[model samples]
Target: MSQLITEVQPDVEIYIQSIYQTVVQRNPHEVEFHQAVSEFLESMAPVIKKHPEYQKYAILERIVEPERLISFRVPWVDDQGKVQVNRGFRVQFNSTLGPYKGGLRFHKSVNASIIKFLGFEQTFKNALTGQPIGGGKGGSDFDPKGKSDLEIMRFCQSFMTELYKYMGSDVDVPAGDIGVGGREIGFLFGQYKRIRSGNEPGVLTGKGIGYGGSLGRTEATGYGCIYFLQEMLASQGLELAGRQTVVSGSGNVSIFAIQKAQELGAHVVACSDSSGYIFDPNGIQLETVKQIKLVEAGRISDYTLHHPEASYYEGSTNIWNVDCEIALPCATQNELNEVAARQLIDNGVIAIAEGANMPTTLEAVHILLANNILFAPGKAANAGGVAVSALEMAQNSMRLSWSFDEVDGRLKKIMQHIYQDSIEAAEDYGFEGNLVAGSNIAGFKKVAEAMIAQGIV
Candidate 1:
């Protein structure tokens, strides 16, 4: 795909491309990390042109590289007593804003590249949240699916044994992501406490409520996505009420996004899992979905057993084929590509907000922007998860828990401010109405300014 810096001055374009090429050469085979850095550096063209100090101070060079990368072995015994080994990683991308913060995924797809990409994106996402958290990500290539409770517990214990050495309330704070959730968090936190001999709840987020978890952390990312969508629609004198929407993914983020969009009067007709997607023209029954996915822990195809009227398809990404006014890609990175973007556009998609990190490819993003569709990048739209994580850190420090309503209200306000900040930043940099550039610039400027203020580290 062509880079977004093409339209800028030749010198600026050359500078941006040089940085990107350097990133590629230094981090060979890390396609995901390369993609993230390319997208970020492309947005830096206007910034570098307007503020040459960033170049003078070598901010671009420093920001693209992670401060630390920790790789360790995680060996655990399965239920059958056979030993297994999985590689784990923690990419501390940046700490200029504050301590490193991000989630720990436990999917088989996880590797150094995936962790670095997530950490790089988390840095900007945390910055946009107006929180003190820095950017980091960690996970293992350990597939949590089909693992028994004891097996998972053993794995968590083994993983945290190595990871706990680097974690602290004032240092790195890891949360749940992908295959990691409340149950996994409980096991990991238990292991951390056992090893460290301290009750530092702030060391992690997404804990069970009876423990030290925040009330609305589970719904923050999904609900925050809709809140951002609400603000984006309102900018054009539009309302979410009565809009037809399709949200991909059936995980925590997707489920809550569907719930909030429905609450606001939008008809969310479709959601998906890795196996396939389910479309309910009568509007998805959130309770049934929760029961099947969360309680029963079954496949999304089973959603049709409860509601025969709905149709289930075998392809997950094909969910975009369903016609809708709004599209929320809440699934993993690059779930929606150029074809999906064009499909949504052909079907009259007026707006899109990413609920997952870089869910849409750069090509898809360009296609959406060229068509004048309202696009909210994941960094700005899905910052809610990390934002609430920051809040949970505060709550843990104060030894107080906020009510669900209180946390939700705060999440809404933070999302609003992020949207507004993106708008103002975009306009200030002569990229008015282009939220992709706006969000990148807004987030980049915040971290870059901090990096400059603190001097070379």
Candidate 2:
């Protein structure tokens, strides 16, 4: 992780390293969190040199730690009438800009390390959106797959019964992530309302449209990534039109990214799920993918059943092997490693936009940058989801909703600004055209400035 930091003044690099060491000591065995902190601090070396006051105020040290970490036991009864328990967590990382805002993920991989990493990343991601939202993240290790609807509802109820006490319209707003989706959000929202005996839709986002969700929230993250990609490509005098694309993960993010990329004239040739990936040389059939993933909640393998022309691979990561000019990793964190990055680079990948948080490893990121490939970090590229979530919060406060076009327009503009802001921050700090450093610096400066203004708390 220390090797990730480069091109820094000696004193600044030492300071950054020291802060990262303390972070690791304080949170041992939290590999994901350590990776996130190290990657972020790598960008801070220049910032520390440019802004000496940040060091005087200990911004790096303070920013790495969370304001609060809440863990509780979620107890529920399964369909077999047996009692079950799972650990739930909420890491309120930072609220300097505004209230805590992030998402709740439900998966077997949920742990303090993962949550902290996501929350830490979310803090910067939210800051880049130009929206009044801070950073936080929560979830349980309860796997929703293969669970009955009733069982899932019971779990959500139990989770909400304990979580609602810390949530409110202006306190913290949680949306959907990995395992939690519209159905799960509805259950959590219902339990929150039932417990408080009040109607406050603003307390939660990614809700059902009937219950106050925004029209374009589902499509925001994917569309926003493409928008950011558009700006990044435009910066290099390139365009997305007719470019060969490969988007990993067939979930909401990947699906919408493919759809939007196609709309903008990119030909998405490959997409995947946890089980496997499909390479459709004729361009992916979005409707069939939507049916398997969204409608039936089925596997990506079923896609071949609908269209015999497409080729399905057994492993998910192999999707990168397909030659493409644009590669968007929309799957889990670290899904694309140095090897996959080399594959992309050797195969002539011109651009990569992370639709998932930290999907590419630190080494992979360096390799891509070293190759002069246009790369957009997830914090900046994937801010679309939370950007639209903030818009949903605004709509809820106003008791009104905007049309899809309206919300989408706002989302597009926000992404444009984020791209510009990142580039400006990078250039200002002598890391010109480095979106990774640019995004990290821009977001850290925003939150750090706010934290300083608010004083040591």
Candidate 3:
């Protein structure tokens, strides 16, 4: 709540006040969620200044409060014949453009606040893709890690039992995020099919390819991020060739970002997991990292077993201190802070693209913007995964399968268009070349216009 932000968005001030009240009442302890919302709202200052009409719909208030919130109790039997109960939630945040679409995360940290924030971000991310999909996210706090296959299946079935009632092919379609992968999707889809007694293949995305998943859905996010960076650099007459890049997170997005970076002639020097980061000055071999992460499903420390040149750091925040031209944070929210931002700036890092949701803090984003670093927010840059997921839904409905090249071509075009829109938005706001401002303004305008036309629904 700075004077500058208020001055830029006087009308949005009411919406921000509403968000604060809602956060205080419902989720006082959700500091991270508040941080994400505050940061996003602050970034929308330029949009509010340019389009005062957006304030009529109270976009921030609607953005904070989901259109629909569904919570259900899931009862399932464990392996030891003990009954276990978990809560499942699906926040159908918005559907202004089309059907509700997003991922269903099954992690220990899944909560109403987390899902709400994710869903809010997904709404704009979906709109930025220029696709006919809205925003919704569902998940449970049921941790699937180390659970027996039967146990996981039981949990998914019970969760889907309630979820199936609210989902359909042309309604809310969920995909995989942190923990809800192929196995979880398979279980959820099976239960949905059984419960509904119909063969609605488009009810969910990220299904097994054998069922209805797209060919490049798995690698779309990471590859899409790199593709965005590629376009950003190409606009400046540069490329990834021979540049050093540091990527945080060894998950699906980061792993493929590393691979695609290598494919584009960039040398990936660092990667990390939740435990810590592994730094290899000699450049991390994609095959080695893939075998250690994908095949073995091991931690980043296991990477040193094959590549003795790499070193592991157990706890550190300044991953950008390693020095590189490109920094892609494929990790969780606010992983990159002002300290990391300053380090990146000092280390001569030229560009940053978030592969995770709101990976950079507000201060970090401002620092990057002040330094003129080419930065792309997660909502715009990482919309590829969900975009392809939507494509998967389209293919499923058509009973058609596209080749790898065809799907990949569409993904690349979508990402490029997003980048172009972001650039145009920045220029329109008089912050030309600032992708941070560009992305926020571009996405906010789309959602705001839809909300206004729909008359506060």
List TM-score per model, in order: 0.99, 0.99, 0.94
Reference-based lDDT, residue 218, model 3: 92
Better lDDT candidate (1, 3)? 1
Instruction: Please give, for residues 292-393, the per-residue lDDT of candidate 2 as tens digits.
Output: 899998999998898899999989999999999999999999999999999999998999999999999999998998889999999999999999999999
Q: Which candidate leads in lDDT?
A: 2
Candidate 1 local Cα displacement, residue 334, angstroms: 0.6
List per-prediction Cα lDDT, in the order shown: 0.93, 0.94, 0.85
Winner on lDDT between 2 and 3 is 2
lDDT of 1 by residue, 1-457 (tens): 3445545688877787888899899999999999888777767887998899999999999999999999999999999889999999999999999999999999999999999999999999999999999999999999989999899999999999999999999999999999999999999999999998889999999999899999999999999999999999999999999988999999999999999999999999999999999999899999999999999889999999999999999999999999999999999999999998999999999999999999998888888998999999999999999999999999999999999999999999999999999999988887789888889999999999999999999
In candidate 3, position 236 carries an lDDT of 94
Candidate 3 residue-wise lDDT, 1-457, digit = tens: 3422534445556655566678667767876667656756665766766676766557766766678999989899999999998889999989888899999988888888888888888988998898899999989999887798899999998998889888988889999998887888999999999998878989999889998889999999999999999999999999998999999988889989888889999989999887888899999877887887777778888889888988998864556679899999997878899999999999999999999988898788888887889898898889999999989988997899999899999999999999999999878766689776677777777877888888867
Clashing pairs in 2: none
Please state the error at residue 453 of candidate 2 in Å.
0.8
